[model samples]
Target: MTIKYPAGGMVSKDVQPVDDDSVELTLRDHPLIRRYGRLAYLVIHGEPVPAGRPRFTRQGHAFDPKRSRDYKKLVSEAAALQYHSELLHGIPLKVDVKVYRHVQSSISKVERAKRLSGKHRPIVKPDASNYLKLIEDALTGIVWEDDNLITDVSCSKYYSDDPRIEVTVTETGAKRPNNLKEPHY
Candidate 1:
């Protein structure tokens, strides 16, 4: 039987009878799997939107503002396109995200050139952590089982004419080493 991938294309599944009462279905080689192996790299084109502070009503109910919700939706949709059928579960993951914002139009040509050339990066708010937070929340359940499974995270921001967010998730085999010395105090 053929199963369709959400993004596009079709993958053929082989069915084998395990017993008289049951059968096992196995997926053949998928394009995404062959190309990226176990790692998932996604790029969302457009301006990066940082997660905003939660808004509270008079009754003390907290809610996300429209902009934050919209950005999260955008991220979720983008992630869905590259999602694999099996979810990454019970394994430590490492996530790397790079957020690129367009350079200010009011800036001088030289400044814009510098920004585009990476000589000057975006050091202004909202902070890089805010962008990372939004991405992590949006990718929950889509890319992996949960964001908490991510043991290593790296985030960066840059200025560019073409604004976009790039995310890379990979399974980290073996636990990271702890090199911290005992406290003397």
Candidate 2:
């Protein structure tokens, strides 16, 4: 806490000595005491925390505190501004969820492999735990208004337009001329 004085007002140059047994002064009566002494005394013993601070503009500018006439509103606005920086980085936002089918290893096939190998050959196989995976993406068009942040989550695969050259075709690929034999009855 800092102490300030009027432009022309004179303040004591020397500090006063306290009694040997004096306890350190605390602000139990006045949580904050940087205001006029008359009002401060009225609130020192039984006053609620005063509501007096400057409002912040939407563009992040704070108006001169001395010019603010509504002390309570000023204080409230300042409180909102004080925490704005932290909020933007960790805002708890709702993201649009997109779910689609992905080729997962058939669980039955994995079980058969494991049983045949007596759990020693390869119990944990690639594509063994084939199941639906949910892809979550954050939509940046909205601002988060909640207090908690979404740091940890479950995920699968995300859809994007990036091009890639896969060497081998998947099992569901379209039938080709050489592989077009009909199933025998």
Q: By TM-score, who's the top model here?
A: 1
Candidate 1 matches the true fold with a TM-score of 0.76
Q: Which residue pairs does candidate 1 place in steric collision?
A: none
Stretches > 4 Å off in candidate 1? 1-38, 178-185
Give per-model TM-scores: 0.76, 0.14
The best candidate by lDDT is 1
lDDT of 1 at 110: 95
- CA RMSD of each candidate after superposition: 9.1, 29.4
The TM-score that candidate 2 achieves is 0.14
lDDT of 2 by residue, 43-102 (tens): 000011221344789999975344223322322232332222122223232222221222
Model 2 CA lDDT for position 136: 13
Which window of 10 residues has the lowest lDDT sum in candidate 1?
Answer: 19-28
